[model samples]
Target: MDPVSGELKLFLDREKIRDCLARLARGEDRRDAALIRASCWPDSTSDYGVFAGNFDEYLAWVVPGSPAIPVTQHVLGQSYFEFDGALDGDRACVETQVISYHRVDFSVEHRDTTIGGRYLDRFERRDGEWRIAARTMLYDWFQDSGVSVDWSQGVMGMPFSAPHFSGRAVGDHSESFFAKGKAR
Candidate 1:
């Protein structure tokens, strides 16, 4: 193999790893089981504060819990990667930061919360495809506040924001329609 080709392969490998991280966030936000599965290896394992188990068990734990929360968002942040040149040449370790948001509307009061964390992941390339072999989440900090702003003032609590009578859904592309940022 030539030096130039080797460099290109490295670049492609890095991009694939990044894409896998993005897919994890997107799949979780959308509650897309198959999409989430694609980001991990068949024998992957996950450790999030509340749940720690095999990939299948992790899925079974999270999928049901996500819908129970009225609103949630997994905002991604910077990711750093390291490479090793040993028996596991195609293996890389990644540390990715995530800012998570959640909302709960109780009859008496509404609560808005945010959690900060990092995902420590082990990525492996199998059959030229990169996916997570292991993932561990580390929660750094968090804040929960009483709802102080009027959602009806912003584009948020408006009637036009909803497709049906109840209200707009959160955590998916459909909800992105009313968000502030430009579409991606």
Candidate 2:
């Protein structure tokens, strides 16, 4: 049987992990780069299979050229977390399954991509709060809308743009904020 202290720690750890996933989903949908950064430690490393970098680089990659389509939702499944005991130490390991939907707009078709992955995370209790210290992503499977675009034709005569282009609103991206502050 688990001690009262151990049970409480487990519960808190699970909740914190869940909250982290929720924050990540919200940040991705609203393009809140700061929120995403807050979810990780200052010098955390991420391994995304193809790309491996620190947390700051990960945020830059996310908010810069996101697909300009409808919002996305990240649904987290049952997670397994093991706390390494606060009395012993302040480290924990978590594994969560994430199912994400990416609403994308193509030249001829508008659809969403369903992607599933596993997030393996190392968490630390810092300043009485749980924060992700490291993360590694494993892509399990993905399904897309199966739409293809031709850059040569510019997709129904649209102007030459990026494959993920969906035309963002002014001031929605971070560039506008920087420009305004610089002009002040």
Candidate 3:
């Protein structure tokens, strides 16, 4: 009956869903197993194009393989939530735009790989806590052509240590994780 109350409920629902997704992203970046386990439901399943599987198997595959890299920013936009008056849990759908770039020294345009995608999520509240029931990642476009790494200099135009893992190496890690599950 009250618009303010409705808005507050939506805001609270959205915030909880956002926080859960953020925690998942952080866990992936840091390769934190505990964080992933805590954020996702025990039976949660993620559909990311070719890679879709249960929680534990996915985590085991992802946690150890991810390499250390530059910072990643996950920008979330256009989130929608629906809660049936009779239902106890909240259902939320969000669109996320993730921009990931790597730079050893200079943060230039050429060194950036822009990837645009949307995250469709369904969250359910259980025991006063929210958990993701199902999630999907939809990629709209991805541009990989970027600046060349100057390996001869061993630095990206600045005095710094060389990258332990190259772009190819990082890619291999991802492929191994996602591909392994698909193979089986």
Candidate 4:
């Protein structure tokens, strides 16, 4: 019974941690600071080549409305975990793969930069919750290419519009997954 219970707890904790990562990715893609910050502890640390600092500082760097990159998409791959058997199994290390795409536009031309990398993270489960304590983003490879797309028009020449019931909004008001669940 002891082993079974411990395994169950570990499973649940892993799920929670993965959920946090997913939310963080969604937050970045959606430009939702609150959602992004919710995944880390109050005193978490982040290192993204360009900057290395606390979670609050990280938020200040990317949060206030729109992220520097106008459009971004983060694709989560797999996560590997190393557990530290402490009380309540509070400590863990997770390495995850992420493929990110950022759009760069200079009016005359449109380009997309793609980055393939891993997020090496240390997490601590506090108060029955798992949150990132320290994170380092390791870049493995990257590529940039030019592309053309009109946000205002779709392939069929119709307005590139998201369905109202789809819960895809321009802002947090409706486009959010949370909003979609609460909407209907």
List, in order, the clash count of every candidate structure: 0, 0, 0, 1
lDDT of 4 by residue, 61-166 (tens): 7665333356677899999999996537689999999999877666767667899999999998888888899999999999987674655555556764653322
Q: Per-candidate TM vs. native?
A: 0.79, 0.70, 0.65, 0.83
- lDDT on C-alpha atoms for all candidate structures: 0.77, 0.72, 0.63, 0.79
The better-scoring model by lDDT among 1 and 3 is 1
Model 4 residue 45 lDDT score = 95
Global fold similarity of model 4 (TM-score): 0.83
RMSD of each: 5.0, 8.2, 9.8, 3.3
lDDT of 2: 0.72
Stronger candidate by lDDT (3 vs 4)? 4
Best by lDDT: 4
TM-score of 2: 0.70
- Residue-level lDDT tens digits of model 1 in 109-151: 6678889999999999898899999999999999987773445
Give the better candidate number (1 or 2) by lDDT. 1
Which candidate's TM-score is highest? 4
Per-residue lDDT of model 2, residues 7-110, tens digit only:
77667767877898777766666667877787888888889887789987878867753565644667888888777756445788889999877767765676
Residue ranges of candidate 3 with Cα displaced over 4 Å: 1-3, 67-73, 85-89, 100-113, 147-184
Candidate 2 local lDDT, residue 70: 48
- Structural RMSD, model 1: 5.0
